[model samples]
Target chain A: HLDLHHYLLLSTESSNIRIYYCFRNIMKELQENFKKLLKTERVPVFLTSSGTGAMEASIVNFFKPEEDVLIVVGGKFGERFFKIAKRFGLNPICYEIEWGDYPKVEKIEKYLKENKNIKGVFIQICETSTGTFYPYKEIGEVCKKYDALLIADGITAVGVYNIEFDRSNIDILITGSQKALMTPPGVSAIIWNEKAHKRLGVNKRYKYYFDLEQEYKNQKEKFQTAYTPSVNLYAALNEALKVINKIGIEKIEKNTSIMSKATLKAFEEINLKPLSKNPAIGVSAICLPDSIDGNKLIKFIRENFNMYIAGGQGHLKGKIFRLCHFGYIDIFDTLNQISAVEFALNNLGYNFDLGKATKKAIEVISQYKGA
Target chain B: HLDLHHYLLLSTESSNIRIYYCFRNIMKELQENFKKLLKTERVPVFLTSSGTGAMEASIVNFFKPEEDVLIVVGGKFGERFFKIAKRFGLNPICYEIEWGDYPKVEKIEKYLKENKNIKGVFIQICETSTGTFYPYKEIGEVCKKYDALLIADGITAVGVYNIEFDRSNIDILITGSQKALMTPPGVSAIIWNEKAHKRLGVNKRYKYYFDLEQEYKNQKEKFQTAYTPSVNLYAALNEALKVINKIGIEKIEKNTSIMSKATLKAFEEINLKPLSKNPAIGVSAICLPDSIDGNKLIKFIRENFNMYIAGGQGHLKGKIFRLCHFGYIDIFDTLNQISAVEFALNNLGYNFDLGKATKKAIEVISQYKGA
Candidate 1:
């Protein structure tokens, strides 16, 4: 599944002039693919670098320097929004939440009611650090009621979970190439509604590379980027999107949810508890027992089984670990991941039944009938 | 020569982790190839977007907001420095030169002596619009004597012309992928000395995407970009650089010089004159006669011969035309270009000797024995 044969074939013929001539067509097709996947016609998508760059673009384009904004920080990725906002000189009022806990919509509404001058509300749909999924639909309603734009960082949530951009009233939605898009990292796509566009028109930031207005004008008029873009990356992304469109995003989302549930069920068989109170579909964060070190278990799994899993970040480091079931993954991958965890835990002298996790994972996998 | 067979082969096994593991070695090899081509040990190259983005990086990294700088405007690209500086809120002292004329070093030195507050001197080595090659070595010396950074926009000058970075004392040198580097357009590279790095360290620009400090640290520590880079473009650029390194920059420069002279001789035989007082090697800008329309002539050549050539920009619109002989081009390309121009001009009611331009071009081509 990680093979780049088709991507290589597409890139070999990518000359500047040839790429330029076909760029508009590729962009149109890519946008159509995103529209189908995102299920939105009111929001327009623009491609850029990674999610952080897109977040910076959303902040710089929608708000001027020193403008008041509200940032909801649930985890590391959510905290990134606060940093980017501060870097751009915005007055960000950070609403902090516990690492594994979801943000309460009532608290967000009360804050919005108190601070009536907030220009935008920045939050993540899925906090990748602790694998917690926020109540973005309800939060989007609060932003709408308060007349503030809602920028949703859906880097891990977009394709892994079903997101209705216009229905959720998301003003700006951002996603990256690596997570659920199933392509290699490097490119990100941003979708914004007309309200965000109108707010962007009043922004006076002196940006050149990440200028959304120039990008919009060029993409609208010439169907090209404001600057030279990576044709090879775009070609790869087009192929990845074709795969997603063929399999259907709904099926992919269903598969991810099934995989996440199966992994959690296997963890339960091994007596491992989940860290996230409101768990996301893409990843399941498990809290390591006091007897087992999270980092050592991750290293043992990679060294013994030749598989890599993510360790915890920030304050959760050495206490929690994350298992990803996102992007081009299936039942076999989930079963193998659960088996590796069982083997590593057993090797570390933790009291767990041999093959019990694998049996539970197999039972969960047998229930799913779709490919 | 344009086939990406090797590029495809290299990209077929490109997994994200694999690409990451091999990125440092690829960047090291690429830097070695560039070192061989540019013959410089003092200046280190860092890759980014297009030349324009690199130009923005050079400005934002070296100068703070409201800082004084000297901009030598000879053509369209030279004027870009003024606009970018102004956009960053820098007070750029514009030293305007005629479109087809080169900037005098003595005048620049006089300006530096009078101002004493200029932080850097920004100019293009080869002005693409007018085909003018400035005296960059003398300008570099003037900048050194005045203790100001000398930034040379060598987008069209790098491989087509012989430039010794250390010998010329250039603080910063910038180039693009679409020019003499022979790769597709998407990436630009900037090279600078310790002096420029020191200047960049003190800059307080609130930039994220184009942050040179972060890029430099990432490249130094992990041999990776701060953001996800287009690996396929880097693969293609590596291939292109290998070709350049094998041929030797001196021979490539000789070939371009031969091609430029051949094209000029052909134009002279057809009673056409070059626009620039000091013309560059890669392109030749010709001012059309009042009886002939430049745009119509260009369109005629493109339609009849299925070849594309660049038209004039800005004030030179409908007055001048340019023929490019850079990047993976040979003597045959020059001959074909001259033939197309001859054919187009003759079709446009300009009476000239039939096949006279071809004979002059062939005569010039015969003088060069090396590839």
Candidate 2:
């Protein structure tokens, strides 16, 4: 997602105020729609450029340096949370798990008990890196019991994978414009609980650029940002939010979960193993055969089939590729992606049945259930 | 000229990186052209989001905090240089002048003897606020005698007004994208003389985002920014820079000087007094009748005429209205602006003459000497 603040070279002046007006109107609409669809009124919204920017804002502003944080690490994103916290001089008691597995809440609780001055817990609702969803509701509860703010990275989970910020006791729920928001990568949102806001005031060294105090002041006054903002992207975001409000989050998440399950089942039937055993509620990751490099496969699919599937980032690069079924993607798009993968694998001498994968995905999409 | 770096929020990676790319591309193209045109082998280059950002990079990176700086203060921008230097904890010895008066290099030489720790001298090539162009060549020579770097804030002068950065022995030359460069307000550039670069190595304690060391590393490696950037703005900047290169700086400056003189002559012949008697090299600032409020007059033109002329900023507020004849404005635009001012003054029941200003402007435009 794009951070608008970094690019604005000029300090605030009343002259070019129309641009900032457009920026604020679009973001406010997104937050309004998010609250309405997700059925939450307790959301304290903070807008940022990327998923990481939102995550950093949550950690840096809400917690003091040298404070303890329980980072539930599974994929690259969770690990990033730990790194970001450490950069602020915070020692995170990391509850590590394999890429395919979700971290257990009991283990995290034990780690929190052992850690002193523990102020917050960082959790990923859906890890985009490994296609695994951590148990957010339970983790949120554990955090509340320990008097710690439960910060959830819901970049991929917010809309496609349903999350009720208030019901789950998720103190801070962060998301990006790209994944479930169905917009281009440029903006993000952070919804903090009241506890986190109070804690933010306790940490004073957060500075102005990432400073919560000034952002809060600016947002309160004009629904505007403290820095120069991306008015064009905000225009796109306003439209995207309207679409989200119309469909509602429950239906969107149900559709995404169904698409994900169908894709996973198709992979299983074709003898292709899903990367994560406890799959991400939104996207799917599957390991390619050793002969088929994920990078090359991704490149081939993107170049030949016009399908932009994501490859593993960091250490898992060239090993596993992801087929995301979130946001604006529907049953047709999912089938097309599966078909492309099957075609690419077959051409590379890795036998995979295209017909069966398509049939299975269709069946689940037609009979998808929502609660 | 907004110094973007001062206000930019760094945590937004995509926007930060996008700003970096946009700025880098602008800096690269400008430097490449300067090198090709000047026939230089290699040169040190820098990119910042605001003209102010580039100015800060030039000041803080090139000199230590304890160094003495000789500031030539004539207009608001010249005063800004003093304030910025003071922000970096630099002790400034100012050769102060009244608002419309030109900063005399002879006066600076007398002050140079009194300040012993002076490492550099800061002055604006064009005193944008007052429309007074300082004698940079003379000032550069004076700084050379005392072994002090001559830093030029070329924000309003670079393209519309020409300066031989190398030939004049100007140690630091800085500019912003919005003014004479014809780009939107998002990027700024700093091209340092050999002497300034040598001093950069010794300075530490600079903040992370504005740090020169990291920018140098990132620019050389990937043409990528060290942070998230605004790609859309970068695209806009690319288009802007293309226009600058096509016209060449000499042609741009020649046209601007012609307009400046024409506008000034028009003001004089019509009995309208200009802000500065020696006229700023690039822009022409004219004072409204004593009866007409400058801000209200500007507002009337903006609201009624749809013409956006700048009102006097800071202390000059309600004193003079500035018409930017720099970057993209042509003969017709100048004529229309004069007409609008006539209409506005007439509407306010203050002015008597209608076509006199236009005739005077045309006469000066035709007679001014240029290649």
Candidate 3:
């Protein structure tokens, strides 16, 4: 279902960086590549906005104001969609789940059965707040059974996980530039199929800026945006797409899985607890002991080794630290970071075996699979 | 009213590019510098979107459905505002002008005088479609007399022209990253003063992603956005701001004016007609001869010299080609491009004297004054 080959490289001046007009044409290629990257046959429209903007656009474009939709609220990102839906006047039915936990397909089906007015279902492939990867494929199947639209947020999941697009039955999939794409922030994409657009036109003229239909056609034929785009970001992403093509997305996903499992093994040795019941391949969120201040541990690692590890947000703040495993990093880098954190935690008054974590990480890395 | 000083540069990794956590903090500096660039003391909030998105945000944030707003429709960019205002359910009273002609100050004054319910007025400082520059200072003064909030779209004018922000009496100013900022496109900024926020509390949560007030506070105090920002775009803009700072803005404006005048003089000698009644310093849009296909002339110059000069968009298409005078390019590059076009036109079954245009350009460049 996924084709990782044939990534097109844009022609630059090669001497200096400048925004070219022909980049508009190259942008078409970007959309196509993103379609392939997302493993969808749908038309993927790129917006000069954040992933959150795409999240908002997906709702307003497909469902009118006051329409009822179902949202899976697991953590920060899932909650964002729920909030956006609510802000736009949609009656969002929240299917609540614990932080670092995923949705039950049967529960979603039960909700759909209970509410026949529900037009669409929204969920995240990986909840960034808790590093939890939901079974989006299962959810998609359930939504299809009820003839409801399934919209998936793959912002942190796309290039890191090779989700079978057709089997997943996702009518719409969203991702951003700064995550697994290895590009900068600002630009995000909404990939949607005929199944979604046929029922509802790509967009109406009401929300003029975020009119996905007009913009999709505009970029396709006009070779220009309805507005000026971030040409520089596209230029950088041109390079990133080439890199992704060379490494091959499946290989990248395989490595991400390997690295995530390795980090989990290392954490077991160092007594760091992974918070997620279904941990994602993109990042690992480890809950620290009540006595150990995660923020101080993070500060120690940054100051000593100049490496950054993110702290948890929302309710989990100061209680967990996240280690990233996707984009511009490899298994060795992960091992090195775990080694740094191990010593840093020790320096921060947390008693942990220093060298044992790295040893366990090596053992996991040696058992790696796939090309 | 306008002060252009103090640009903050961000710290980057010495080896390679990676989205850093501290980048969230550094993005605050990017917003502050944009305020300085726009010469507004008010809070400037950035959106990971294009100028058009900011335009829509400005309209929806301040005005509810059925509110009356004044729009100056002159060219493609101007019509865009009218269209956006119309699409967003605002009653837009258009003060229409011919393409390449600016708005009459008295006409806007009369519209405000008659329409007491007009809450805001929208105008372009330099309409990109026709390369026309309006006298925004005079327009702003007239809007103030009626207590109308003046929203100026300076996407193509802000970095190229030195406008007195406070003296202009403009309440809200919008600009984009691509134009004179010399950064790649995608990100845009909205610089607003207390006058604008006093009547309205910035933005309601309805448009959650573009809730300016919430973003303004989140970026100022929390050092993070409500959503993920295009951190890499901020990184590139950081370097561009440093470059602009070292060169100084007033000098850039003076040089831009000189280049625009020189371009005008060159076109006059080469039989190219200036399209705009009030041509901007940012670009020179030259009307082509009827006998010559302007598109073919542009194609010839591009193919032969590998240089780009943009042809007109919308109604002016195939009738005019634009000569850019802002960002990265110098006077010599302008003369070189002009010379290339002169020969390209002559070769394309047109009659003209050779080297005369470049000679005329040098005469104007020599007369440039101010540091």
In lDDT terms, which candidate is top?
Answer: 1
| lDDT, residue A301, candidate 3 | 78
lDDT score, candidate 1, position B143: 96
Just chain B of model 1: what TM-score?
0.94
Question: Which lDDT tens digits does candidate 1 get at residues A186-221?
Answer: 567788988788887556645666678878787766
**B55-138 in candidate 3: lDDT tens per residue?**
887887877668899999999888888988887677999999999899999999999999999999999999988889998888
Better of 2 and 3 by lDDT: 3
Q: Write one digit per residue (lDDT tens) for candidate 1, span B255-327.
A: 8888899988888888888999999988899888889988898889777876767778789987888888788
What CA RMSD would you report for each candidate?
A: 3.4, 7.0, 5.6
Stretches of model 1 off by over 4 angstroms after superposition:
A1-15, A42-48, A290-308, A314-320, A346-350, B1-15, B42-48, B290-306
Model 3: which docking level applies?
Answer: acceptable
Q: Tell me model 2's lDDT, rounded to 2 decimals.
A: 0.69
The model with the greater lDDT, 1 or 3, is 1
Task: Please write out the lDDT profile of model 3 over residues A87-167, one tens digit for every residue.
Answer: 777889999999998899999999999999999999999998899999888888888899899999999898888865765
Could you tally the backbone clashes for each prediction?
0, 24, 6
Score each candidate by Cα lDDT: 0.79, 0.69, 0.78
Model 3 spans with C-alpha error above 4 angstroms: A1-21, A200-206, A222-224, A369-371, B1-21, B28-32, B35-40, B202-206, B369-371
What tier of docking accuracy does candidate 1 attain?
A: acceptable
Which candidate number would show the highest TM-score if scored against the true structure? 3
- Tell me the tens digit of each residue's lDDT in model 2 across A179-218: 6665545466777767777886666643334556667667
The CA lDDT at B233 in model 1 is 58
